[model samples]
Target chain A: MNFDMILAAAARLDGHARHTPLLSSPFLDQIAGRRVLIKPECLQHTGSFKFRGAWSAISALAPEVRDCGVIAFSSGNHAQGVALAAKAHGIPSVIVMPADAPALKIENTRALGAEVVLYDRATQDRDEIGESLAVERGLTLIKPFDNPFVIAGQGTIGLEIAADAADLGVTQAELLVCCGGGGLTSGIALACATRAPGLRVRPVEPEGFDDVARSLISGKIETNAALSGNICDAIITPHPGEITFPIMKSRCGPGLTVSEDQALQAMAQAFLRLKIVAEPGGAVALAAALYRGDALEGDTVIAVVSGGNVDPAMFTRALATL
Target chain B: MNFDMILAAAARLDGHARHTPLLSSPFLDQIAGRRVLIKPECLQHTGSFKFRGAWSAISALAPEVRDCGVIAFSSGNHAQGVALAAKAHGIPSVIVMPADAPALKIENTRALGAEVVLYDRATQDRDEIGESLAVERGLTLIKPFDNPFVIAGQGTIGLEIAADAADLGVTQAELLVCCGGGGLTSGIALACATRAPGLRVRPVEPEGFDDVARSLISGKIETNAALSGNICDAIITPHPGEITFPIMKSRCGPGLTVSEDQALQAMAQAFLRLKIVAEPGGAVALAAALYRGDALEGDTVIAVVSGGNVDPAMFTRALATL
Candidate 1:
């Protein structure tokens, strides 16, 4: 919610979250026609940036509340992140996930000591089930993006990007973030607004799931017609969060959207040039940087690869693009 | 070749080289049945730790010599590293590569402004061509592993591991390194000997290409029966380095070898759990950590993923294992 809170969250995440590398390649630079630097949060705990928010929210809770247990609803990445963070603190966690989510996510969450409750995405409401379960078990609900602590936690990434940009002698650049519910985008926008004012934040999403991009231009929260069918399953949200929309409206630049094909291509490029595996959702921002260069400005562009919890079949499909 | 030179290499690489991350995963720990820590040098520049040695060898040269250029011969990773390092210094570079090497590496080497000369691995002598080219062009020859400066450069990784281990409260562990001509293993072994005395470095290689392992047991340099045909082309050297073997024999622990299947499985595990790409050669150490655990020790084990310039087809095959 604020810079001090972000700094506080950064302190709580110390030793728990990975300080991921800011990577670059000449091949990537040539393709983007600019200096492209990447902050790969896929290397974060639980293979996503969600762990930062999960840790920030869970750690800030009172001992009694946290001990009572925590619960969250996620398609995949956030489920594993919260599961791992709760397991680390020796607390019980309940995760409500869509039944069709990647099998790896379901198994990993359970492996991390979480009770995974799967529900039909088309027929059942995950939030309703999660809330009822939380009430019955005295579990604290940790939302993916709307929560202040979660935003502050994700904001820590902006702090890192700002520091790295300055270290690399980059005072100005467009910081592109993969947008789902806009938690990551808003948090980073807030951080850069204060720390590296010269750097602008932009949200990127899959073509049909470009609610954030639409919302930014309309100056109001916009909703997507469909969410579940996209290849970028990790970032397909119905709409931007209430808390996140205003931050993007005020502090972020116009949003960008990339096709599923571009996302797949970006994943292959990431594999070949950067030696990093990026899930489709995680590759969207990079996709924009690489394929949508005509609309972008700046001598240097920083893109955040937000997650890498992709299934192998999908990964192989992405690799096929190469 | 020594700790001081490694320290000096680190100094020169302070801003130039990526201070690659030391990653860990509960999934990897569960598989290895021990606390598994990964130093993913695959995330290093040019998709391998070879860049460290290349930069070290090139940067330490006198200004006049460095300005003229550098030359190196390799299967792939070292060629790219040397090419990129030379390009960064605005110096011309000549890379002699195997005619059958990965097409990606050959194209990348040429793309990085290096004149790549392809030679037949079965008949042509690479050293003679490299030496002749260096002599004719007034270029300093940067051997992949045999040179003292190159060893010192690769040893910088050991210094990093020592510092990271100390920070994480790990004083003693088996540091598994993917062995090529023993450059990385020896460099890390020598660094750990002085900096983190409790940590023991072990060389890991693919089966049939385990010359470093056999040489360590015999207390003398040993040669592999075959020179090519392995999928792990990046690390299939004929023999241990003349300079590196003595240091590895003196300072490192007993060597370990893993089957190609295990390497492929480890590559999948790295993709699934660690979210980093690992070439089969790079995955051998990780393979040893996971499948060859019976031969390892310590409460914690560190595996260095040495390179990740894998072809898409091979990467797809690795993913199929998941």
Candidate 2:
């Protein structure tokens, strides 16, 4: 609701979150017929931007409650982010994850010293499980999105993007972001609105899991039929978050969607061009930027590679697709 | 020779070169029994630190001579770095390369709009070919590592490392670098000497091509028996540069070498842990840091993943090693 909250989050995450580099490639520029700046959050702490929101939410909690514990539900990135942040604060944490989530993600969350509670995406509800754990254990719930502090924390990236763009002498550019519950999108949109007014922020989603794109069009929140099948497991939230949708509706341009093949192709391109690993979900914004070239404006465009916590098998498959 | 020159290069490369992140992993810390800070230059422009030296050398030439053109001899990374920097400066550039170098390197260099002249590594003399071309075309020669401007340019990374380490509260750390002609090693060593006094810089090489390592011990330059067989083609210089070796000898602790298998394993480990692509040559320093645990001192260790211009087949092979 307040842009000041995003600024507050930026101050809080100063020494904690990485001010990830804004990378460009002549090869990618030629492909899109324009300059493209890549914000590689794939290199962020915990291998994703989720750490920003996780830290923001947990750090804002009352000390006694935080000391008690925190509960979260994520397919992977968010779970690890919360686990690591909690550990940093010396607080007990538990994460509810899909049993089918990337093996690397599950292993990483556990490695961060978080208790893992697995549930079946086919028949069980992760939120219900997380909620029950929170209630039973008297733990604070840090929802992946739909939280003010979490949204504000993620908005810090927008501030960096705006500042970096201005530093590069780019006054205006098309900004593409990987979207799930619209938390990252809305947060970034808010920052761009105040800091880099010339940027046109847009949300990008996987083809079948484009609830946010549909919601943006209808001017209301929408839900996906199912959440289990996409290779982009990280951004397959069922719908846009309540707190995030209003902000996105006010600030974002039309959302875009990319096919599974396109996402895999983008992942491969990122490896070849950016020399950074991008998980399926993380590559969607790049996929949109590459495939939806017609929609881009100005000579410069920016895309965020949001996460890189990919399983070896999945990465191998993405590489083979190239 | 002067640290002030490196400071000038940092200024020149301010907006041009990426101020790459200093990444840390607890997993790697547990393995090495020390905290490891990864400088992912793989995310750098041209996918390597070579751009720094290339720009430094080319940009220092007189305007008329620079406008006339430039020529250089390199296996891969330097070629691309020179090509890209030349393109940025709107100057013509020619690169003489080993015909057996990675195909991806050749393709990328050519794609950057450089004229690539391939020479047989076993029979043909690349330097002679480059010299002849430079004389014929009135092109200025930009020696990859031996040039003072180039060394100063590469040294900019040292300034960044020191600043970043200080930000992380790491006053002292063991710095490991992949060495070829020792341009990068000497450059960083110079920066550390003036900027981060507590850092102990060391050069790393492939087992068969430990010319720099051997030279450090003998107090004179040494040459590798063969340059055509190593998987780390980028860092397979016959000997350390005259300008680089003396500086390295004066500042560096000692040189280290890793076997081919160790390099490959390190490449895979980088993929798994850092989620970044590191070429075999680029992964050598990381190999030393991860495996040569006994050699490391202090709680914090910094290793440079210098380049990521690797052929797909080679990367596939490296991944398979995991």
Candidate 3:
């Protein structure tokens, strides 16, 4: 919860994870009516910012725990992140994933040398299955967003954004972070609070799954009833995490939500202007910035594109939507 | 031609140009049989490395010359680069472009506030038309690749590649550079010869327009019979430039050529793995690295994805091919 933990995580991740490029586009700037700086974490290892938390958590484990290996449940990005981080640490990893997850994500997780355990999302509880597997196999469970190490790890992105913005002589700006279970948003809020106090942090979510937005307004946690219908699968967590919600409430401003069409437009814009591929979940913040320009409050705005592990068919569909 | 000019260009471009991210891919490494370091110029301003050269050339012009304006002939990337650089300098620009050029490029060039004059590639002599326009308007003619400042500006990318590779403990590698008129290739060759002495710099060209490759083997300048048939319009210069040829001859190894299919496949792979959009010409070097794996040497290899100003249809076609 403290800033020092994020700094320590950054120290651990230095030279290990990619310091992804902060890109700018004239076309995007014109649409938002402000200069837009994109922190493209799609370029990060395993194609998401999840790797940072995964590596930080696994690498900090006790020798005995490390030897016992680890287990996690994710539909895609987190699975690949934990799998790759475990492989780098020369430890075994078992990932419990939904059977209907994107084929690309499942294949990539397996390609990273993780044992895939598929469960029917509608019939089985992923948490129960993952917990039992971890217990029976004597493995440490790496929670996707609820873990302290993961939050601290994701905070490294905020550190980079502050540093990069300062390098450009920008002392004040607004940050739009794509929100799922509030891990990335809260982590970034904490980092910006300490590293660049002038920044105004906000969370962006898809329209149907705006738990974080409603929670911020209500000053409490909220849950989404339907998740399988949204295109932003990577960020369709049922509700904000218990640990992450308080930090977001204290540090973040009101959240913003974008429509599916807006998200698709943002993805197309990222491809056309910045030349980076962005997944539907990752492009939500950018969508808010581009489509919901009325909320912009600074000369410079930063959008965190969280992941790009998209199936080609989905990517084609996004382009076709544009 | 000297390294000092490149250093000076780097200084001039310190805060103005993007120090583009150097990306690595495990999938690409598996294909090339070595670690592949990608310098994605597609993320650069104006969607290509041409911006560096254009800025270098335009920024160095005399006040009166800049006031008189600048003119250049290009298929697309260079046109947009020159137009943007000229606009930044508060000067007018006129670009002579092929009538059949991609609509996106032409639209972008005009959007940057450039005057576009179209000429037929099959009938009209573009060079003569460009010269006549320059003379009539009393504008400075900015030759795309045959100029010294532009070459030095492009050389900055080589400096970055060498520094980034060394940071990762890679002192030796084979460099695959996309070749048009040898500006980018020769500039990189001189840079590698000076900065990373062990790097084997090789030029990559399209199959039918392999003048650079033929010239490197024959120890003389060569020319392509036809120019309008190739899909890589951005790099279909009939022959290597008069100024760039000497630098390539002295500092570069033999050039390599890839078929159009290979280039398209490379573009698709860039999208699937690197998550960057690459034009056909820009992906040629990566094609050489991926398809011509037998020519690879050392533990590390660097491929320059030069530009991303590709038409969406072309990009869709590339993805469909995979």
Winner by DockQ: 1
**Number of clashes in model 3?**
0
Every model: Cα RMSD to truth: 1.5, 1.8, 1.9
TM-score of 2: 0.96
lDDT of each: 0.91, 0.89, 0.89
For model 3, residues A81-175, the per-residue Cα lDDT tens digits are 89989998899999988899777778878888899999997999988998888888899999999988899999999999999889988769889
Candidate 3: which pairs clash? none
DockQ of each: 0.89, 0.76, 0.67
For residues B217-281, write the lDDT of model 1, one tens digit per residue. 99988899998778887888889988998898889869898988999999999999989999999
Each candidate's chain B TM-score?
Answer: 0.96, 0.95, 0.95
| Model 2 steric clash pairs | none
List fnat, each candidate. Answer: 0.90, 0.71, 0.50
State TM-scores per candidate.
0.98, 0.96, 0.96
